[model samples]
Target: MAAYLYESSVEPHAMPGNATASAGRVGDTSPNTLGAFCESPGQPYDGLPCAADSSTCEDRAQECHGRGPLFDKDLAASGELGGYGFASNREVGRRQVAGVREAMGLQGGKGGMRPVRSAHAYVDMGGYEFALANGTRVRTCPAAMGAFSFAGGTTDGPGAFDFVQGDNKTEGEQNPFWELVKVFITPPPSKEQAACQAPKPILLNRGFAHKPYEWAPSTVDVQMFRVGNLVMVIVPGEPTTMAGRRLREAVHARLVSSGIFDEQDDETHVVIVGTANTYTHYATTREEYAVQRYEGASTLFGPHTLEAYIDKYTSMVPFLANGVQGPDWERPQPPSDAPPKEQILKAISMQTDVKFDAAPFRKQFGQALEDVQSEPYRAGETVWARFVGANPRNNLLLEGTFLAVERLDAAGTWVMVKSDSHPSTVYRWQRESTILGTSSVRISWTIGSDTPAGTYRLRYFGDSKSLGGKISAFVGTSGNFTVG
Candidate 1:
């Protein structure tokens, strides 16, 4: 019995010309100080003649530049991480930890951290660009996936939630449909990254604003990072060398101490960092803090060095490792008395019709059948199942299910594959379903172009109490679609 871990990031598509407008708490006030890019008057901006006086020309000029005027006003602006109104990664990380611990039966009673048969996590890096006088360029933070590796589960999972879609959906449909599922908070698959269209002015306007003299961000980049239970976010700060690194360390420490690691101590951990979520300010190291010093000093951690910086990190790690505990955050464990097999089967079949694909089943079954020289039609695979619903109304009905698919291979050996069954929008019951959602477990394998083609049978089992007695389907295969 193996468990799987998933991770990913969520971002609203506010790009221009989008069918619907985007909305949410876009910008909110942040701490007086952000990461390391110190905020104060007289900070140099692109070598422009910044006035030395604090309350006079310098601060006033910064306040005056609203949308443009480029560099001078930009001097006061730190990176976007410092100002946005998004859920803090520190909090997200803590919740993930608590959820898993409770789910595995480790938090309450006498049970310690339970062994996870598998783990999956995903994070969203807001975007790839950050603003500096020269121009926007690629930025990387420690936790944006580059920092660690994820083990124990499949890499494929749901992509980041579409905030733009949520905005367009009626209130009745605004459930956190994709919230708890895990995705890999990975880097842009390639350098040709996707850019969000400019958001509607209203959506853009919701961000933090500048005071008479206070600093603000001209742009934002949001990225998500995940390693095992840890989800790290790199928010851009004012473009100070130290801002990004320092903030990352602080937030990372906070999450580690929040019980994320402790909850999954037995599993191999991974870390994904970089700019993927909304770009906040850059989190820089102590060395960067010293080299490119700025007034944002108060915002940057004091002591200005990596050794000192790491020390601060160690202290907060505990908080991030063990989160605030109460009954509400606990995940439900399987009841002591296992339900009847019928109930389990029903639960497995309880999925709504999503566009389905027979590829996964075909591949897994095909491989086994070919290997053993048995007919692929009879051999099948079974997968463990779990259901995760967006709301409580469907919670009991959708939370967990086990899936078992079986077939006989070319040889007589009965091949079975089991997955901790779960629902996803990607799996469509048929190719032409009107609605789009994620569900289904696909198991696939490839045959060479020259290999013999034949008909096959793929059978699937959805075993869970919530399914209400639906029967599994069988797909008869035709010629192999193997590419030469």
Candidate 2:
């Protein structure tokens, strides 16, 4: 739900009177970091070991909330991988797109691709030790951490504790992905591997962990784009609320101190746009990180995550100091060694066609049974429409809307006034019966009190699958109506 809203909310409605932005996933530290420090399996809320049959959200949430900026003994000791290593290639390592392991020097071998290991790895198969930045070292192994991240799981997502809607913390712990992923959880190592791991403590998955910043390119670059007095700091990761707040303050302070603006000047404003440029990881305050929740465990840069970001932004202040072309102490950063080339994983389709036994239940994919309501709607009222829906994957609607409310313009341009991204708008999909290949879509727009009085229409765009198993796109429009 959050990921779907991110592009629509962040890209379009960042300005005042815009859409609300929510975040979902982030490019952060290896998932193993959590198991090592947090994932208290079978531990109940009262800190007592769970009985034979018990594991609740209260137990999980209580155990995890406010845990860290805690140090990973293994990752901290791991240090950086040395030598002219490989340069990062997102194409070869898509998972590393957002400052993941490959960028942190986990892909430090000689070549253009990050090293790959079998899911059944039993040792430090990913070369996590010499794989980090040049000067770091680690006692833990990656395969062990892989087991924890992939096998043992954590608090969020396929984690052991995730709860579904309406779940009251009393349901059993089970994730949908567990069945498909359990095999990948590296099996317990052999005698030698076990010996290597025996000396190491805090093996969350009975494996190792990756230090976030152990890479040759330790100092990351900060990008600032300004249009007039509005300065935007584009960070590499999904910085926490605190991280964003501090960044704004630091940039604002720099601009004011450099004589670019007066104190608390109305003409100047600064904001932080996280998950920009290259993906680093989470940026949290030393305080928040202390309670290692999902955010802290993912704060790859340790306790001073925000402080490091502040310094990075401060260094770039020289650039924003004298305008866009001012002195940049860190521009044209020196290049590092190239990463090794390795084959990356590709997507495989497993979709099959469904044959409907009844002619009426047979949907030619994009057939709509219930069209939108056609009538005058006043402010505070909701407009609804239902359609014969198909798989939305046929048309992802990237940087686009699945639904739109257009208000006719003076010259009849039909400008887009509202979209599925709007807070008051809702789009839902349901398969009335998968065996019958019958499905329906519901879209609703609760007119805001401030909505302009005008004629408007709702538009829904989707894709349908043909009997021959071919998927194609289609659109449905609602009748125009007046809003008063």
Candidate 3:
């Protein structure tokens, strides 16, 4: 189910509703036309080819119009570091996905539902929240928000959990993307953003300081990945269509280079948009952007739009290539860097096996399994499942999976996969199945000697059967379960 609670009465549209007034008279000029927004220079970085103070209209016309070449020069100078080239953003995105799929090798004899799903958004302007029927409530947003970019009341507020959810308002020389990314992929104690309000460093005592560059920040965009119902979140910076396309291409290029999809359904892998989070921006065709118009020339989207395009164009891939067919779907082979299948499943099981000091299950179950089916999982110690009948955006059945990671590589780099490994298993209902309207499966697992005795989880990846299947479905419950 998809539900959308707009902050304003205005709906999401291609063109701005208040454009006429905000923009000059029709003949005078468009509000955000190529001449105004694109051709006009924008905020200049220290060495990017741009006019001094290119952040405003005045700068665009006076200094930027002529000096803008400097910005292009900077891009050329930085080369791959600036997220440029055919092998840049698109290549990176594609590689990341391939790496994830390679990392999550399927396991368990394929007869049960697995937690696997993906989430897409044109932009996550106001952020969003989700509560699985199991009572698992997860809230996500850009690492930082502010008056200029994210446009929410500044300050993480008194109840702020951590800088992970705070607002970033520092203009110029501050890279919110990098800050969030560092916190995401790397270790903890990620520095708090330069606060928009008081704008001061928090708990930062680094011995050295660094200069800002027009480089991709650590916080790329946040991606929701699922294998059956098990879900993991990878939030990166907003992907511009072409810009983000590099990331997507990166994955595909790897698959092609690594020969993962050669014998399988190459046409089946796809991308989709318009759901869950709306964190990125405009997406145009290569021909479209070449026009050098407003939408086409948007720097934000220009560098990142490829990801969105992939989402739109490839929406049907998972369903055709990986969705349930002949009763189940199988994950492809793992890369040399992937984790072991046993380890992945064990970790997934542990996430589901969350323990509680008190009686968590009694309070949740109450009576019938149906009663517990409508809510998310409270902290407990059983392999529990919840299904929501609707989503906030589409009001359709919402489904997803979440679990924990048991072990990282010794270097703590990427996940370590075992020989012939896959992370989770997926199952679909057949005409002869007996689990009510659902399908069923049985899995046999052996905890590795290296596995620490703790809570683990097993999840079924969630995938939307709608909208071309490029986008990942939301998490919710459609029915209850009685272990037979």
Candidate 4:
């Protein structure tokens, strides 16, 4: 099959509510006219780029913010400070769709795909030892988050504090207050541990801290899947561009040498499938690790992390060779050490359970608090309705929606045209009175330019919990409004 590769951005940060927004755009099959690639960087307070090393503006990370293509427009339209980034998210998704279409058009499909083969293993990354290609022996340290992790987060979400990224300060140069606080949170790293994670000034010695449970994963899942000449390296964490490229090359070379695919086979492809199976954090090239940026600082297993993964994945290539299949196929021995089952069993959750939900006296659940306007609304205008609501945690509404935008058809029936899944639709819940157990929900829809001109109504579906904790469903409908 024809293969196409596109590298639009490195470490493209995600925005709030973007998960549903982007998914909606990708699912929408509508034609798009947006450009195929758009580079979005953090918006600077003074309209200048953020500091290269710390990603800060005036030495303050909170001043640097990521801006989407439609950031200003969305912010102005919503009037919500620090806009949700929905507009930009959808635009990016549209660009992705356009890119896919262009790529497919340029290279038509050709099929001779091979059967799928897979391999998986659970490895304790702590102290994993191996030899580099140059005959240098090295090992990975236990998982530990560095001070730069708190370097006011990333451009995607700037955090509080005086910390900054790319911080490689020696102990004396480090913040004296935080240095004392670190001892109270988790045990201070020993000299050996500190040396192992050199250049990464430990903020939290997660692997060594096991009070409530394992703070960081000591064991991670390593897996791979092969189809035809294409091999996917399933990684446990995010891998930077260079790190991922090195991994792919290492695996590709191994596959060629193993005779699974000849070096002359130009069709052979290896790709990195990141953040799969488990989470360890980020993987960066040794050079990037040395730089100690946000990504490199978050590289849990020290500077040798990428090399360790490359070594493990390359060693497992022989298992994916042709004819390695079925019950008859003999597999190598499994690792003796696996992650402790208690690590999960003893895991703790700080989130409190839903107590109960109730509507104000004489205001029944799902009762309309603010109905839609009677006047006609034009395309691109937003219409909304608010209702007395309950704690939605009472019912997640899986395979269902909390709200819908219905269009009145010629047959005199309301047809569900849009749900909460649509990028243009939003479902927001707010607690009005915690003591009274009262809440409200606002459902809004931004009418698309291409939306059909007709009468439409807003509907809300909710579930309320009684004093005894019984959940009952309710529905509310708003009066019809014209879209012209």
The residue-by-residue lDDT of candidate 1 on 1-484, one tens digit each, is: 0111122222222111212111111111122111112123465553343232221123232221111112232233342222221113333344454555565564433245532221111221222223332554333221111100101000111112232111212122423332222222222222121112101001111112222221222223333334335444333333233333444545554554554554344442333233333333333343432222122121122222223222333333432332323332252221122221222222333556423222332232112222212324222221112221111122222443222233345775544322223111111122212232223333333232232333332333332112243323322222222121
Scored against the true structure, residue 484 in model 1 reaches a CA lDDT of 19
Worst 10 residues of 4 by lDDT: 20-29
Please provide TM-scores, in order, for all candidate models, with all chains considered together: 0.22, 0.47, 0.22, 0.87
**329-405, model 2: which lDDT tens digit per residue?**
43332222233222233333477534431113555433456655566788867777777776565567877888888
A best-first ranking of the candidates according to their lDDT comes to: 4, 2, 3, 1
Rank by TM-score, descending?
A: 4, 2, 1, 3
Tell me how far the alpha carbon of residue 276 in candidate 1 is from the true structure, in angstroms, after superposition: 13
Instruction: Write the residue-wise lDDT of candidate 4 on 1-484 in tens digits.
Output: 0011122122122212212111110110222222111123453346666776686777777776666677666567444222676666667676665666575477533387566787878787889999998999999999888885545576666666887878877766788998988888888899988888888888888889888787888788888888888888889888887788888888998998899988987877887877777878888888877777778778899889989999999888888878676632355423435754556678777888778888888899988999999999998788989999998888999878999889999999988887776667889999998888999999988887878899999999999988898889999888899999
For model 3, residues 1-484, the per-residue Cα lDDT tens digits are 0011111113432111231111001111111111212233344332233321222232222222222112342246433223222223333334344544553465543457644444432333122233432666433222221212221111111111122112223333345655554444323223332221123222221111122221112123334343532222232322234433444454454334444344354342323222223323333344433432333322132322343333332332243233333432244321112221222222322232111111123321111122223332222112233322111122112332221222233464433221112122112212212222122222112233344433333322232223232334332222321221
Instruction: Tell me the whole-model lDDT of each prediction, alpha carbons only.
Output: 0.27, 0.48, 0.28, 0.76
Could you tell which candidate, 2 or 4, scores higher by TM-score?
Answer: 4
Residue 264 of model 1, lDDT score: 42
